[model samples]
Target: MSLEIRIAASTDAEAACNVLRRSIRECCELDHKNDPAILDAWLGNKTPQMVANWFSSPTNFSLVAVSEGVVVGVALLTGAGKLALCYLLPEARGQGAGKALLARMEEQACSWGVKALQLHSTATGKDFFAQRGYTDAGMVRSPYGVETVFYWKQLDEDTTCPNAPKRKRFCNCNSD
Candidate 1:
């Protein structure tokens, strides 16, 4: 199914939270695994109420992908040019929704004069970001103890860094 991407509304908070929670539980095993602590910490802040708060943030811009009026994906960008969140339901994976979501969010950020963009890529998303031109900024230990890579890209210039150590494991989510 194709997705229509658009700026998210406060009304979309609930559905967006659903997509975020499900994607984390069903699609992020490679990164969070069966660790209850990690999962809890990662999932804790993504409740619908928190999503609404995200929408209310003046410096945070968000987008949602809808298919037949149901939200299936979400991407959030902060005023600091951080790609704060990017997720899609497992079924929506590989349908180009992920790419479209990121592209639209990136376009919006660029239009806002964002010169650079950065995100912390879980082991599950390093290659996905790498393939889309993000550079490795090294490993960061999350509060949950997950060691993930920080990725950054210069939107105003062509700068690439591909020679970082490969993640020890791969994710099914990134496969075709």
Candidate 2:
């Protein structure tokens, strides 16, 4: 079935948190490298309650990607224009879920009058954000102590997507 993107409800907290945790553990092998300390620090605050609070916060917008009735991805955009969280399950990768999540977040940001969006990207996500017009700003250490790439993207007032060659299929890839 196709993926469906929508605002995350309180009940989805557990599933969403699972996605976030699993995404970091599996997809971010390059960043954490199976280091116990790093993984613990990174996932310390990712409890279901925290996820629910984040999703319900007035200053934040949270979304989930549902596939076959399962939550497979999650993203959170802050009022201050930060793309705070964007993650997808290993099985959901290369299925257009990430692209759809990002596009939705950008749209929500523009609607909220946010002129730009800033985010810290993992090594695995660097190329993905770059291809979406995010400029490499610099480097920063994540709260968990992982070196991350800082990226910023200025939003067009009109918020229209630019044209690109059609891909043969959806594959969560920067290029097709």
Task: Give me the candidate number with maximum TM-score.
Answer: 2
Judge candidate 2 at residue 55 and give its lDDT. Answer: 93
Error of 2 at 70 (Å): 0.6
Model 1's TM-score against the true structure: 0.86
Per candidate, the number of residue pairs that clash is: 0, 0
Report the lDDT tens digits of candidate 2 across residue range 1-176.
Answer: 58899999999999999999999999999999999999999999999999999999999999999999999999999999999999999999989999999999988887777778999999989999999999999999998989999999998764432332223656886774
Write model 1 residue lDDT over 48-129, tens digit each, in one string: 9999999889999999999877898999999888998999998888888889988877776676767779999888778889
Candidate No. with top lDDT: 2
* TM-score of candidate 2 relative to the true fold: 0.89
Q: In model 2, where is the ten-residue run with the lowest total lDDT?
A: 158-167
lDDT for 165 (candidate 1) = 27
